[model samples]
Target: MTDVFETDDPETDAGATVLEVRFTGDEGRLDRALALALPDLSRARLQALIAAGAVSLDEAPVRQGSAAARAGLYRVAVPPPESADPEPEPIPLTVLFEDAHLIVVDKPAGMPVHPSHGHARGTLVNALLHHCAGSLSGVGGVARPGIVHRLDKDTSGVMVAAKSDAAHAGLSALFARHDIDRSYIALTRGAPHPRAGRVETRLGRSTADRKKMAVLRNGGREAITDYATLRVFGPDGRPLAAEVRSTLHTGRTHQIRVHMAHLGAPLLGDPVYGSGGVSPVVREAVAASGLTGQALHAAVLGFVHPVTGEALRFESAPPPAMQALAAALSAL
Candidate 1:
């Protein structure tokens, strides 16, 4: 059900459309009206378009999706969907290990694992395509070939990609069974109570915010993390923050971030979950560190070689931003 809407705009891409919607519903939501007017577009997609400033009503920008629909002409610009087959880009990769069956690399922060809506280029997939020269496994699909698992876009760490289908299947099975050793280092706003403990919760999409993952009381996948405070920083009398090492027993989306936030000690610089007061000194250090996002890093990854039956493990230190942040916190 690919909707390819053509428009008269000369600059529009092949599948792009510029919709002119005439809404007369006075009480209906703008997004709902647009969705009804353009049956091809989903209501969620319409809402996103409205939020992205892609929709204008009566020659004025409409910022709210829930605004009351006015009797006016609305114009919506629908950008063309990204191509399923991502073209290869010659992005540099820090290769840790490579073979005919698999490749391991230390992925840097800000690099997405694959192409998505806002990140359609310069991803790890594009780099893998160029590096592997089209020799990657297709089991993960064309867009995300060989991707058995993923770290968040802002999280830096070691990653493995399979180059053969056998390796892909074996690695996928290992992840499914939770047989991989995965550990993360998080610089947190405050220390979690009990210094060392296990966090087990059911995690799912938040009912209040669809874009966020939350801890649910029921009806979600189980997530577990074993964590310990490696070091506490700040004045001796008052602990302002701590360095945490979290080992995952189950991999769920944003598992570490959500769990840490649930403990009232979210990671530093985490825009989504880290929403609380911080010591002025620590905040200044975070600013000085120049970290664009959360201070979380995938510090360790260990697994048995899927095809070769060899033990393999990889470790990576935190990036410069996190290191600087740690140093600053230590001085506090």
Candidate 2:
């Protein structure tokens, strides 16, 4: 049965009337309360609103840093009008391979992989939902039906989605065991020493900024990235382009960017972990290719079919930006 709640009376514009909500003793957190009461909004966005003094309890403003509320009867104020609609927008996608068990898509950069705070619609998942016509498997959840893994919003590449529960389980297991073969192509500022090597580091949340991840010695997970320089040259023999392929033994947040930066080579357009801006030569080359964001792509993905047990491999060419960069480097 769908969860239901009474809406605040429309007569009062002090916002909606205060609706008294009695916690069941277990689900009393402000975030949980808002989630239960307002099922339409995402948990992250609701939490942000609560943190920003937009949500009050019993007319008393709740502290942003406060933990979940204890079991009690509290009045929650209705939120203000939203400035933007989170409705899904239809977008085109490139399908590399599709079957009853899975789908491999050539995801584009700048398009979010899933719906999130500012990106409520026009996501890869939303487009898939529309294109697949409700045929996607409900393995993860209603919101994330066939999702098994995710790529960052700005990262473009080949991603797979399970079309059935069995496929979902099988794919999840493969990823957990590091059995899937995943390869990425990246354009960094400088060539790596030795031209080919592996980087092993422990990564954890940054102490200085909770929002960022960093390589940490004491408290972090082990991350392994094996990279080989595919090509290295410069516009005037000054060392401009470095094309490297990275294979992840252990996936960690910002592993490639962090490890690359650690090796004195950072991704060209990464704003957070590496250099924030792009070089003039790199910018001109990338613009010719008509692409924005970082020059990274999931060029290869390989795995066994969940049902047939047959080996399957998929590869995608670099997007325009990456291609343009390659051509410019070739001339150099």
Candidate 3:
């Protein structure tokens, strides 16, 4: 049941394929037809081949933008593979579930999903590479094997990574369509006013700052977050912190953090979206509990297995820090 498809391209010494594909389909356009027939070959690469006269129809070079009028045999020449090389590091991983097609991990806070500008090592990808032993998904491309969705460096909990190209493509599509169920637990400074509601907005890169994202009024992706205050606690029966449970309808960067902050309940230790000042009551509790960093955990992740016709749901409890903080909050 794996979503993966393989072309019978003749293999080569360098492990690359010089694909020569021929097919007959309804008359429409090369771009449209090729994409439908071969979901794996990238559109950009297909268009590149057509423009360079690597594709032909009835022995005539098909224009890159040609619109076919009828079903006919079309031939294409696909390029060979390029070497994939990424350094694998023996970093530890907290695996939740593993199978031939994918791996579900209980990712800890402070580990980035992949290498980035400021983080070059100690990432989940580096660790996964070493653990998979070369059996990670390649559909992610650029040597970013097995990576699908990501959590912020400060967020910890249940996550899934694809172990094959087909699984990668299928999972990626699932995330894009918002067909997966994902929930998070967050410790916000103040309780949401209504206690339970949904926040919907258009989100994009911040115009004021390139390094951050903002809820824009125009020209941005749609974002929606549903949140409910699980409980509110403080010292001496005074409200100090609220445990909020949130579900995502759209997966935008910092969507929950931004929406919660916009609603006037910023998360504690959120250096970016949090209120710069902390309430004295919560501050004292944090100090005593030794809690630091954003108190967000990906508590629940559920999805249909791409390679199997089965429903899969995984849950992880908050890490020690979050549990300790919550325990302290209950006492106070």
User: What TM-scores do the predictions have?
Assistant: 0.94, 0.73, 0.72
For candidate 3, what is the lDDT?
Answer: 0.80
- Return the clash pairs for model 2, or none: none
Whole-model Cα lDDT of every candidate shown, in order: 0.90, 0.75, 0.80
TM-score of model 3 vs. true structure: 0.72
| Candidate 1, position 153, lDDT | 95
Candidate 1: pairs in clash? none
Off by over 4 Å in 3: 1-85, 235-238
Worst 10 residues of 1 by lDDT: 1-10
Clash count of each predicted structure: 0, 0, 0
Residue 275 in model 2: shift from native, Å?
A: 2.2
TM-score of 2: 0.73
lDDT string for model 3 (153-177, tens) is: 9899999999988789889989999
- Over the stretch 28-135, how does candidate 1's per-residue lDDT look in tens digits? 887877787788999999988888888887779899999888887788888878888999999999999999999999999999999998899999999999999999
**Better by TM-score, candidate 2 or 1:** 1
Model 2 local distance difference test score: 0.75
Q: Residue 330: error of model 2 in Å?
A: 3.3
lDDT over C-alpha atoms for residue 11 of model 1: 47
